[model samples]
Target chain A: MSGKGGVGKSTVTACLADGLTRLGVSTGVLDADLNGPCMARMMGVKDHKPSSQNGAMIAARNAYGVPVMSMDMFLPEDETPLVWEAPSQQGAYTWRSMVEMSALRELLSDTDWGDLDVLLIDLPPGAERFQNLADLLPDLTGAVVVSTASQTAMTVVSRSISMALNIAEVEVVGLVENMSTMVCPECGYKDRVFIGVETVEELARRHGVPYLGAIPFNVGLADFLETGRSYIEMHAEHPAAHAILEVAQRVHFWLKNQSK
Target chain B: MALKSTHGPFDGSMSIVYECPTCSMQTAMLTNRAETQMVRSLGVKIGGRTAPEEPMETLRSNLASGQEVSPERPAPSTGGKCPFTGMVNDAIGAAESEPEKPVWTEGALARIEAIPGYIQPMVKRNVENFALEHGCFEIDEDVMDAVRGRLGI
Candidate 1:
């Protein structure tokens, strides 16, 4: 949601959605990444398209009945590119076109979303989109920031997280460090392919944000997504899945505590 | 809207505008420092994989019900001048100092392309413009626009 692009926001989102569903909690994954929506493919529901009902946009329901809507669904084809400029466009288009195309307002208001226990909005990367979401819906609950352990990623993400907290005035729930390391299944050896995990936790603690957990760099996830089935469902014992479920439980319980 | 109280303890509502002349990209951050921090804090929750349900849900629902969701009206300005000197500083000051080096990845362009629709085009254009301005590559508009459009720009 609050991380730079390609930092695995969608993967984490999918896992949490699956985790919640596994708990019998009704959930909806709203893709607000209007400029580029790929949740359909990541969720293994690439062919599902959103429909309209009684002037309200209908979200595409996954096999598990989780309602999903994204820009990818409306795109003519996966290969076609979106070339519109950020500040300039013609014929009822603007940077706002991206948000409007997502039908974010309608999706939130009109859809049956059917008494959702949780609705995860997959916001685009960077501060600008999140800032727009802030202006569009100011009092919406807090945000989660994603970061890699690299210093550059941390620096940019720090500014982003600061903007979310300081400029948007939203509560920061926690931090998730993705691409931490890869653990060899056969040898039980942990490899630090990218930056070490400590950097992320240190940054989170320094900024006073909760350090949730890390997702190791796993090639299996790519294969898992291709099959349209979550690794958790198949490899419940996978360390990566275990880490994800840990964060999911913490997130669930944290939300419950916030309500109280 | 009338220029609201510019004098005294500056609230976290100052507007900032940035113009990158080399590539012709200008953006503004209208809200103040405090608000940015708040948003970033909320982003932690967002990035951490949790949703803020109660307050946000209620606010969104109210807007859905056609309620006017504007904040309380700002106070009228007294036409205050800059306390520093009588001469008003109308123009935005110097841009934030450039970082010592580029922060973007070398393969950022290819990475953007892998994303679903139009985003690739959009980000690619910005990157090209950035590269041209910094002298990383030569500028060729006809070729650039075409390449940019390929990204769906």
Candidate 2:
């Protein structure tokens, strides 16, 4: 998952993980936010630290039933505002991003991922300096582009997709439009909050990529999300959960068929 | 991202980060410490040198923030004007002619040798300053010639 910062990348990633779990597929989520990770916070398990086993660190499972590890989990709860210089920051990047990527590879290779169907990699928002994962690991499966309906986000998303395709040579599986519409929980009236903006479907169509459909904005989902509860399990009838499940099913089908 | 500094990589020794904002194209110091620090910090494999634009005002502000000022001296107008830039290099030359500061030992000489070719000149200049302040030693003429050639002085 990739896009510019603050564009619902983590939310979509959470939904995807939740969807995969609902389908009875054991999924492992790796939060590759090297410098400053927020996945642990999003998963509401920032305090749950992982322990070391032999030379390697064991992955921490969140309350939401996803195996996750991130720099935030290791740091203090109030350490968010601390400014880290390049050197100290490098230690985190090496341990959290690069080494974590290596650990994921070893997990897939050495460990018996019994009955595991998919591994979801939750990447950072922007494709900045530390976003060279494809170069570091050549065995990266194709990625899904997460974007909002904003014009600037669409531009960055386009560049990110193009970059993954051309430079990284990773296939662009699809584009998921997050926060497409906000519906009133009381009246059930849907309002195009981000009206007149190009959705991910439009972006995919323009770039000759597959449009993976849109996710509705819901506050109940947000509350569940903030409280680290599984949205699909809590609100099975929610529009956002259904949309994400459909996308996840399509992704699973595509990946499975490609293996054949 | 521990920097795997083998010999083959650019090592940022020969590659200098030049701030060519003005016509003079002033050179910025890409010290071994700075280069390795940046590489580790960024954590990406930089095949070659990459130049980022820096403003003079920003640099000056940084110097001021550290309570350090450029040594106050006129540039060496050996002729009436600077033969190179024609703007006064006199500021730097004048500072050079003043009483030498106490020398640090050749403690960092071996370290400098590990650096790439292009940056050797600055290290040589530092060594020359140290030697002159302590006591000048005559050894190899070829090395002196190479230093002069590289520095174009």
Candidate 3:
């Protein structure tokens, strides 16, 4: 999944992986966002460290048995930031991207992902990073773009979809609109959060891709995020969880058709 | 393999020796303006060498100054044009020329027409481009299937 930062790419990835696993599909996740690695926490495997066996790193498994690999697994502590060792502090900016790419390549190649049905990679923000991943993973199936209903998020996400279609020459599986609506906790009322803008369904139509579904803004989602809880498993009846599972079902159908 | 740097006497350019780990073969490369220009044109840096400006900016400056830039291969000979230079020019000319549209067979046209109207144009363009890339000027059902297999769509 690719999108701008703070648009809940990691959250969506976690929920999608969980949802797919619930449907009896073996899935795995790789948090490619090195700078802001959070899938380890989001997948409910933050306490587990990857173990190396036979020169291959064994990924940590979540409650649903979905293997997850992320930079967060390698960090010594939660607050510590990821820093690369360089020969000198001068002019480090130029080669930092190369280092990050090398790190991602190592993570992908060295990890022992044992025959997963789908390995969802939670990508960081920016079209350039997506391009980098396209180069790294030549056999990439497709990209699932996530965006908020706001114009700013949609504008950036549209560029990502274009890059995937035109430059990367990859298929865009579909678009997922997150934070589309909010359910009032005080009174059980659902209302649109962002008003007077082009809807995500229109954006999907404009790009000729499927509008998978919209995830609601749940007030309890913040607590779930903080505690690394499986929101879908915890609150299956919640509107947000139902929306995510529905999107997962559509994605699963798309995958089944492609395999045929 | 260890890398050793030496300072040039006249131009102040740095020369670095790279040793191959497998064969222990040593090669020296001079970090000069031409080398920097070549690296920048390729949108990458070697070792610790950094581009002072954006790659496109450097390429534009080189083009504006009439300096030949060939990132993939060396600049073709200008004073005494070689056969390779002629071939390169021909390829560049072909690329610059209008792209030849591939002819769609009845079967392929029917298959594409069966697609949903909203995505028909996209699928058609993608298939045609795939056909062209594969040197299939006449697109048929086989070509369409090949495109589908290549894209796994």
My TM-score estimates for the predictions, one after another, are 0.59, 0.58, 0.64
Which model scores highest in TM-score? 3
Q: Model 2, residue A78: what's the lDDT?
A: 40
- Residues A76-178, model 2: lDDT tens digits: 4443332222212323434334334443344333322234567777777767422466766687777878888878888888888888877788887788888
Local distance difference test scores for all models: 0.59, 0.56, 0.70
Give the higher-TM-score candidate: 1 or 3. 3
**A1-260, model 1: which lDDT tens digit per residue?**
65577778887888778877776778888777755777777777778654546645567777778887665665556764433212123221322343353346555665656668888888778777788787778777778777778777787788888888888888777888887888887998997756644598898888898888888888878657645665777888888888877777777776778779
Residue B98 displacement (Å), model 2: 41
Q: Check candidate 2 and list the clashing pairs.
A: B74-B90, B74-B91, B75-B89, B75-B90, B75-B91, B76-B90
Please state the error at residue A41 of candidate 2 in Å.
2.2
Model 2 ranges off by over 4 Å: A81-116, A129-131, B1-31, B35-153
Q: TM-score rank, highest first?
A: 3, 1, 2
Clashes of 3: 0
The best candidate in terms of DockQ: 1
Q: What is the lDDT of candidate 3?
A: 0.70
How much is B115 displaced in model 3, in angstroms? 63
Error of 2 at A219 (Å): 2.4
